[model samples]
Target chain A: MKSEYLSEYDNIVRTMQLYIDGCKQGKSELMRPAFHPNASFFGYAGEQLAIGTQFLFDWIDKNGPAPNIEPRIVSVDILDSIAVVRLEVAEWSGKLAGSGVRMSDLFTLLKTPGGWKIIQKAFHWHAAEQRLAA
Target chain B: MPERNTPQKTLESWKQIAAYLDRSERTVRRWEATEGLPVHRHEHERQDTVFAYRHEIEAWSRLRTASPNPSSVDGADTDNLPAPTPIVNKYLVEHDAITRTMHRYIAGARAGDSDLMRSAFHPSATISGYCLGVEYTGSVEHVFQWIDENGPAPNINPRFARIEIIESIAVVHLEVQHWSGKLAGANARASDVFTLLKRNGEWKITHKLFHWHDQ
Candidate 1:
């Protein structure tokens, strides 16, 4: 693979890594550039929609900064301007400690005049009974 | 005219050879479903395992390949076609998020690994449609519930055989003659579109939808 391909892929992996790191460190500025200023974060938890960046920022701060959490990228597949990334995460919080692995993204990354930013986002995760074939 | 023995060209369709060895149709279908009909996939068409000889397949089938090919597509007894393109992939990933989640969940179903499947879902994922000819918009929990209690494994292997992953948009589509060997079995196919989020430095399935040939 060419260095360009590797970088686009790394941008995804590293960008994702940065976003989560921002949340953990309470540095909201860490994730500002990765999203549109109006970018939204959506989640379905118990029939309710968890919305907005600030909603999550507050939640993360209240949740004591989600300690001992480790997020690792399992694999990255690049196709021109689109890519899919699979990841594994572990949280070591009291009683909530658990390991979850998912292949959860189909990103449309634009190599814009400024730089790369996520233009659109969606969601899906694998079932509980699956493994990454090595 | 005497026939020349062009012993080597490269036969892509092992679908025929599997027949000669007296392998069951199920065996052949399984191979076709998984790795693809044992043909060399080119930018255009699949080539034969060897040169297009008259009696090759029949001779290998313990008969005469020359009598006539029974199932050549389009009634033409030649093996050449145009180059392959991304035609099929467009439809496959058109569902986007819904299809992505479906692939992840189906991967879970095939592997008998729950932890592996959970990533393709939200904690609230559910199967809210008809299954076994009944209409039920249930939770992703229910889908996971069934796979846990029941083994959709070897018992249903003969009919519910394989999965094909197209190289675009994370499409994982399948045909199941009997899903997990249910009493009133179904030949169901489904897909969804999905998106990812960077959660704590990791990617997670954030949205998805589904569609199935429900009974």
Candidate 2:
């Protein structure tokens, strides 16, 4: 990668880290800077279609912390002003201990005047049956 | 209420008009054909060279829904209509371009032509996925080769589950059924995820990941 892209790659990773840290700490404020003000969210929470970033923040707050969760950045594809990141999160503890909630998150980020901010987040929560099969 | 100083808003294309009316382009075009929507076409131009005023559309919408028998406005004089101020929405145009690129991929798959499918991808594109419970990760050429070997899937039904665009980058979720490959008579269902990038004014698939479900 070119030096310019290297810097951008670092910046993107830093932004994503904020989100992961927020999940680990269970505080939306930690991840607030990582997202654009008008950022939107779309994904399936069980059979329900979960929309809006507020829903994510509220869930993070309610679910408390997931200190033992493992998140892997599968891939990051960058263009001129936009990028997409695929992340696989596993072992996220839910209400019950060993409830292991795994998820696949696809995030779209834009290099706005304010810097790289996540514009959208689309996710899929892996069901127990699917996880066992995998 | 007093009249406002703002100029009469004109929608430049069928996409914009549909968006303003909160309907699909197909639905709005059907309305123009059957329900006498106030749409004006530019003379000496193609059929798609059309425009409509928001006020006119609003009036037609109200009458079409409220009245038992809505009067036709089809033969209205176009010479009297105000000149259209073109509002070229780049987002809508780009979305159409991306959709066309996806269609090329689908067309290629339906015919089992690797050359046709290659046109929709960037030269540096890569593909990673599982085929018949085996993990395969490599350049997109492997996929093209596999498609050529597997032959055409004329009966496959593909659906665009979701398309998320943010500026120059996009991600598409495609669901396909009856995708016949190396599994003999057992047609397979697959969920494909494509990441696309707009380069040199053209959108191309940069990467693809897929999962073939149990037969």
Candidate 3:
């Protein structure tokens, strides 16, 4: 890969790391560097679409003085100025502990003038019963 | 033979017409019904023998697919078509975002993660597909809720056969190998077609139409 592409890739991975680490540490401010002001999050808690990062931030505020999170970057794909990162997290602590849900996060990032910033975050959740079979 | 651009070159039967178009007769028939593909009947032969003009089929395909130009089509002027290298490169570059969207979709389905699936589509999108030989049509939210309540298929492997983008609109042909909790032991293969739009520099699925193979 070209050096420019590699640099961009590294920057994106680092940006995503900041967001996940922020959530784990309950430092909402850490998320600011990684996410765009207009970034939106979409996920299904049930039938509802969990929109915006504020709710997640609030949840972190309520439960995460510190969260025990094991986050892994599953894959990253980049083309031109856009990149997407697939992430999986196995958490045994915080509010999510004992919930028995397996989650996957897909973050869409753009190479902005300020640097790579996440523009959108989408996620999936699997119940514990289903996880057992898998 | 007829003059260029004129609807001549009378094809006497469906077989000959299908050969000329390089498609099955069934495909052409579906096109005629759904896409308004041109087909003419002999006035004096009592409409028994179907016929079509070669030029008309070319025009119809161009109009339906919204190609960059008709010249890029087969049998058209090869010299007039733009060079393949740069065009293909541009297409692949543009398709990167779409590929990510699809990957998110598959991951979401397999994991029973509503958030990932929601992220793959616009908020207002709707889906129409078959489940267990039954037709299902509903909002994206409804589909999400169904999956949330019922849980996702145990295994979801989606493979893409083609992704065609014309300007801001795209269509993808995908085959999904799926098996869920409710329906176990039955082979569940689904052919999914997704329509996407590029809005605000992002590609998101706007609509989905699909059918299960066994259904």
Candidate 4:
């Protein structure tokens, strides 16, 4: 029984890696397998609230495909079919150069017949100086 | 011989069930459809008439009040194909805990209970906002201490503007109306957004950002 759960956990991690790789490559198709199709994103773009996956897709379209940004999965917590992941990104360039914006993304995913798929994301942006000392 | 009426042992009509539950008929009907409320329709007789056993409703109520934390439930229940009812019920139970934490935050702010306020936040949590048109950024502990030093606000009411929960993470938007603290006559309204994470089977605010409006 424990082995079964462990295998499921590995599958979830692999699905998440696909999502990160997709964003890095600016290939929506790569990320397609990692999302539930009705997934959404929420965060602040300056003082305004940015909503929906379109914002994320637009940003990826404008800047990836041979990307300069680096992403790392910081943590993952799973309970049954639902899971939460924390991802951090750095090594920004181009229009984002010297903006000093540090991004941390929290994602909610569920295990589906197709494997694990992200259903929602909430982002936290901070200044380089204030990057959570923890 | 068994008694026919059964002396308050069963509810035979929707009206009676609704009244027994102290809810509107519409609400009870919605609960039956959505939350799997134990309501049985007469199939042997006419299928149109609805009836609910008193013992069944009582047992269901006991279960509802018995478990407020989803983590306490047995894991074997979730091992099979995920059912919508159980999943939704688990989320609802977890959501209640989040709201309860928010309410504790409000109570802490009103009474300047730094300890209670601190319990709602992670030790490293930071708060940032403009106070009297000046930018102030500091740790959550600092804010709690500040509340203690300055005394309670005469009136500080926070209404939930929005709450989103995704697995173990949550985002809460609070619209606050505060009067009589540092700014007595001005009476301010603020929009506060809190980012929270469930860690070690507990929820804590990790960050807070707000915009203040003088009114």
lDDT of 1 by residue, A1-134 (tens): 55887778777776676656754565556656765443344543223355555664565454444445565665565443333454444542322112333323333233334445543333333322243333
Residue B90 deviation, candidate 2, in Å? 35
* Chain A TM-scores, candidates in order: 0.61, 0.90, 0.83, 0.79
Candidate 2 per-residue lDDT over residues A34-83, each given as its tens digit = 98776666654654556678999998888888898899998786654556
Candidate 3 per-residue lDDT over residues B1-215, each given as its tens digit: 33334345777677766666556666555444333456665534112346887777665554443234222223332212122333335665567667757766665665565765676788767665445556455567866776566555545546777676655556666777644544333346666666666666667886565655653
What shift in Å separates residue B113 of candidate 2 from its native position after superposition?
30
**Predicted chain A of model 3: TM-score relative to the true chain A?**
0.83
As for candidate 3, its clashing pairs are: A43-B115, A44-B115, A123-B115, A123-B116, A124-B113, A125-B113
- Shift in Å, residue B192, candidate 1: 12
Question: DockQ for all models, in order?
Answer: 0.07, 0.03, 0.02, 0.04
Q: Give candidate 4 regions above 4 Å deviation.
A: A1-134, B1-88, B183-186
> Once superposed on the true structure, which residue ranges of model 2 sit more than 4 Å away at CA?
A96-98, A128-134, B1-170, B173-215
Off by over 4 Å in 1: A92-108, A120-134, B1-215
> Interface RMSD computed for candidate 3 is what?
14.4
lDDT of 1 by residue, B125-157 (tens): 333323334433334566666566544432222
Q: Which prediction has the highest lDDT against the true structure?
A: 2
Each candidate's fnat, listed in order, reads 0.13, 0.00, 0.00, 0.03
How many clashes would you count in candidate 4? 0
Preferred candidate (lDDT higher): 1 or 3: 3
Candidate 2: residue A37 lDDT (0-100): 76
